[model samples]
Target: MSKYFAVLLLLIFSTQIQALEKVTLQLKWTHQFQFAGYYMAKEKGFYQEEGLDVIIVPADPNNPNVDFRVLYGQAQFGVFHSGLLKQRLEGKPFVALAALLQSSPYCWMVKAQSGIYVPRDFQGKRISLLGHTENGELLMMLQRAGVNTDSMLLYSGKKPFDDFIAGKFDAMQVYSTNEPYQAQQLGVATREICPKQFGLNVYADVLFTTEAMLRDRPQQVMRFRRASLKGWRYAMLHLEESLAVTKANYATHKSLAQLAYEAEKLKDFIRVSGIPIGKMSAAKWLWIAQLYHLDVSQFHEHKADFIYSEVKQDPASLSWVLIIAAVLTLVCIPMYIQLIFSRKNKSHLR
Candidate 1:
């Protein structure tokens, strides 16, 4: 009886040990090099090795608010712009798990020969602006730089790349990665005016999760974070492999050379940030909150203590621990019941 009971316990424990955890990750944007780390992690089996089944969902531009909606409860984790996350943290119960890009990738681009020397040059000139939080940041930047944002004619539209190339606007707020690379590919002479150059340093991409998840499933969060950080480290070290993974995910840009360029550019941006990957500083958070005029007090109240500064354990080893613990728990349960029954019988005999 004891041998059968032990075998039964072992089988149950083994089944529990092999149980897979499912996690869905929401990307901030469509498939691009910006999210190459996650793709690399999936491709390299980092998540699987960590005992996680991760689904990476690319965000739809048409549904701009989809990330927040999914993150509120629908998804276990979400990739988002730190600025957007900062604003949402004011009222929403969300906490940033890690900072992906240490620096903002936003910049103003102009024709190389335009000789537009300074922000003052943008005054009274036509400028392309994307309507959203970026527009607000640009407005603030221009105000600080003594540029009359209202004096300039604003071309509010999507994919301002074509319009800028057609000489529709003197300059446009373009992603330092995509638009600039696309322009160079077309042989368009352009120069990037980094927002950081104009004192508009903001944190860009971040990994975030709801406060509820952080509290209820902290180990899961740690596992995901460790796996993601490992993926990023691998991507940075194995650049060519990461690019191949990116190409596989975004099939439209079928050119390997283009994919390589995109990957190299992302690597450069990451290097220039000076901060190591996955490190989010308190000062950066404070600056973002101040820039957005959000009430930081609200965030402090709910999530001040829950933010994970670093991974507490090796993600790769957590699964084994869970498996062992589950096995021990299963084995001990029946033994405890039997011991209780034997004790009761002895008492009755007495």
Candidate 2:
């Protein structure tokens, strides 16, 4: 009876130990190749291996605010653009974990026949930035090129892309990886005035979480980062497989061919000059801060805590400790039970 009881207790402890920690990841946009790494992570058991059950929440177009979701604790982690630096400077306790895109995918798209080859050419033109009120990179690019952003006629209305296709706007902001391919499918010959071309490059699709999570659950943050980056490496290497996983599950809205195009364009951004995917440098962040005209001294002050550092703890050590505790409990409990039985028997015999 004692042996069975011990076994039951061990089973209960094992069940408790095997239970995974649940966490939510808020995406910056709808399910697509842009978030393929996260999809692959969940699909390939990377998160499971890290003892995590990650709930990937795709952004609703009506409520597309990844930063808010994470800040308010609706999600533990989120993906955002370099605008994250702007938020950080605003006293938000956010920490950047990884920057998946070494180069910003944003660019200004114009009809090839429009003769607008550069940012300077955008002066006095009707521009639509997909209804975005804040895009510092593009505005900075135009500003540097001597174009008054206020001088340009800005369109803020529904279906900006359709309006651009209809020749209602001279130029519109676009994702080099996504919109260009979309335009190609529609047989629209378009040219992109990418910020990178003018040497105003910045990071995109940065994985981040609030500093509280990093402080309170450091191990979980490290595990999630490890698994997420591993998933990104795998997705980069096996693009076709990742695309299949994304389409079959997360991004049924995107066609394989379109995903393939996005993957192709994203390769340079993801794997820049053999630099490891998701690696970030303080120098780069500071440069981005300078571009945003934020207080560089403030960034310098908080950067130590803003960037991620690995928590040096062995993943298997905790498991070993738990196993040892279970084994000790199993043995000691039965022995104690046997001792109790012996005492009771002696009393009865007496």
Candidate 3:
């Protein structure tokens, strides 16, 4: 009995090890508190609880494209921005899982001394911004404000914030949760022209995977999404521990104060009053797609598939269980009848 028990223990351990699914998550940028949920998921063993061995890959100079990595299968999952919607419209076969940030964090930052106060003020000024697809909210804000985006001088800079400070560019794009804090630390007084002011709301830090992954491994996707959301909830609720874990392990470059500032600012975007964390509303998505000028028919056709839903158990497996149960019942009925008749015969003999 002891030997058999030992064998059983070994088997259980081996089975658990085998059951762990090894997966990779490609991050949008370098390690920071922006990706706290993912870090917490891995750190707090939430991923492990879901039978996942997740490798959180941070963006570096070489590996910067999260979407390319995920779509090409280099990474099983990725965290990206609403820019992913345009790619999906272009037939990229991408699926958005959750929007960690319910509101857009992207904004154009200018020194307080700079006369640029609004999107309209950006006209005829040197601006550092990404492509229209990448920073559509900003562009849309400019357009809505009656600024001809094409007429404005735009360029991408390697050190945009520094350039803005040096008076090279009138304004540079920044994240409300991140760069504002950095500028504050550097003693630079800055003002942000956020898109939300113009009612152009976009989601950031979106978790997503490919359609192929969703279709082929729905259960894995469901488990990963569930665990990731759980991590997000925990991280939001336990900001101090999340900051400590991130500083000590993941983003050492950022000080605790800096992480805390980011955490505090992001709470407004992450935890809305009525909305659930990581919940993506279909109405908001349709509005975003409309902003991109995508085909309404196409958006409608792919809408259901693009948005994620819970994966149900396979019907084939359920049918197999029923078949086995029916067979067992059929086999037992005969034995039960024979036993009753045998007992009756024995009574007669008595």
Highest lDDT against the true fold, candidate? 2
Candidate 1 wrongly placed segments (more than 4 Å)? 1-18, 157-159, 250-254, 272-274, 296-307, 310-350
lDDT of 1 by residue, 1-350 (tens): 58857786777655644665899998877787888888888888888767788898878778755556645577899876755545556456667788777667777899998878677676777888655674356667777789877667888866588888988878888777678888998999999776677776666677888768877877788888888988988889998878777887653554777667667766765655567787877766767777877676754553454255654555546657676677668777887898899999999999
State model 1's lDDT.
Answer: 0.74
Candidate 2 regions off by >4 Å?
1-17, 130-134, 314-317, 320-350
lDDT per residue (tens digit) for residues 1-350 in model 3: 35544655565556556768999999998988889999999999998877789999999845566689999999999988887877887889999999999888889988898898878898888888674355678878988889888888876877777777778878888778787887898899999999887788788889999999998988789889989999999999999999999999999988888888888878888999899999998889898888878787888988898888776664433443465456546655766787799899999999
User: lDDT, candidate 2, residue 300?
Assistant: 92
**What is residue 26's positional error in candidate 3, in angstroms?**
0.8
Better of 2 and 3 by TM-score: 2
Model 3: residues with Cα > 4 Å off, grouped in runs = 1-11, 61-63, 155-158, 313-350
Q: For model 3, give the RMSD to the true fold.
A: 6.7
lDDT of 2: 0.86
Please give the distance, in angstroms, between residue 48's alpha carbon in candidate 3 and its true position after superposition.
1.2
TM-score of each: 0.81, 0.86, 0.84
